[model samples]
Target: MKYSIIISFLLLTVCLTAFGQEKQSRKSKNPNSAAAEKGLIKVSVMYPFAEGKTFNMEYYETKHMPMVAGFLGSNLVKYTIEKGLASGIPNQPLPYMAVGTFYVKSLDEYQAAIAPNRDAIRADFANYTNVAPVILVSEVVR
Candidate 1:
């Protein structure tokens, strides 16, 4: 009888463990899980400064980024703007005047959100910088 009770207890414990693992797997499979678990894609727009070029930081911060946020809405998880200070090499010119990074849950979401608004966004570029912007889309691994 004691042996039978021990065997039954072991079976119950195994069943509970398996059930808990299945529940965890289901939660992870959920689309609305934590942002880190979902992975992120970054879109970087870089503007290289030239000696005779123009870049309106005021308009970019005041107007352009706001418009971008409006268009992208919730799909734009977050964003950051960085002003280039100087190159690590002493006295060297900065490679880029400004860099804007936009993060989203997935590339597909970014493409969907940006496709329709591409022309509008491009039109605003002239108001901010004369330099042609270099765009890079990459996945965040870490």
Candidate 2:
């Protein structure tokens, strides 16, 4: 009876120790360290346009990215609009594209800026020649 009691006690201790260690690890990973340097959030919006489009490389490089950058607040850590030829599938040719990136201080700020005027935001790209675009949102979790 005494041996059985000791075994049960040991099992309880092992379980408690495992739980404690897991909790500590999670807290360390996502610490609310006000003094520690905060991380930036990066959102990449990918655009896919129709074929046979007339896209002025100069306008997108000089004008489009800059226009989006203006709407972002001062907290923007980085902003970029890039263009490249899409890598196509087998026996397929991909079209030219423009990609917009909004890198900010946090996810909440991103939601606040785009949620109210989503349609307007979509309309902003109406001028692109024979093209449709896709937007992808992601958090910079590191």
Candidate 3:
């Protein structure tokens, strides 16, 4: 049940994001430009939604993410934090309350850099959210 909800949320999010991205990507004429795809690795941390869960968006955005990005240093290409708004089922709660993702040039580099800071990152979770986060790592094929 849990995994299904997460999967559903992920599918919905990807479909929406990819729709807009397809049009924008077609306009990029430079093959060797800095924005060109380099097969980036994506690391996403998702917070599942529950009836009584709590999430402090302000602290997460203003402090936690900045601190993490600094710890990642140059290995972190970019990051995004998304807040859930609606679900496929009318009046149903979204599967995830929040999702944070970071893009890295290499998966190995990301693993090495995050190893030392893992404890610190985990410790900071209490400051913003009561729900435990689920991590998903994948290669950006396109």
The whole-model lDDT of each prediction reads 0.82, 0.65, 0.86
Model 3: per-residue Cα lDDT over 88-133, one tens digit each: 5544679999999998888888888889999999999999999999
Cα shift from native, residue 122, model 3 (Å): 0.7
TM-score of 1: 0.71
TM-score of each predicted structure versus truth = 0.71, 0.57, 0.75
**Candidate 1 residue lDDT tens string, 1-142:** 8987787678767867998999789777974545463468888999997798888888888899888877777888888888888764444678899998898876787788889999999999989888989999888764
Best by lDDT, which number?
Answer: 3
lDDT of candidate 3 at residue 124, scale 0 to 100: 98
Pairwise TM-score winner, candidates 2 and 3: 3
TM-score of 3: 0.75
Off by over 4 Å in 2: 1-39, 86-92
For each candidate, C-alpha RMSD in Å?
A: 17.6, 15.5, 6.8
Q: Regarding lDDT, does 2 or 3 come out ahead?
A: 3
Residue-by-residue lDDT tens digits, candidate 2, 1-142: 8987787678667867987998788778877632232466777766665656655657655766666666676757778777766443222455446677877887787677767757765676655544665666675555
How many angstroms is residue 98 displaced in model 3 relative to the true structure, after the best TM-score fit? 0.7
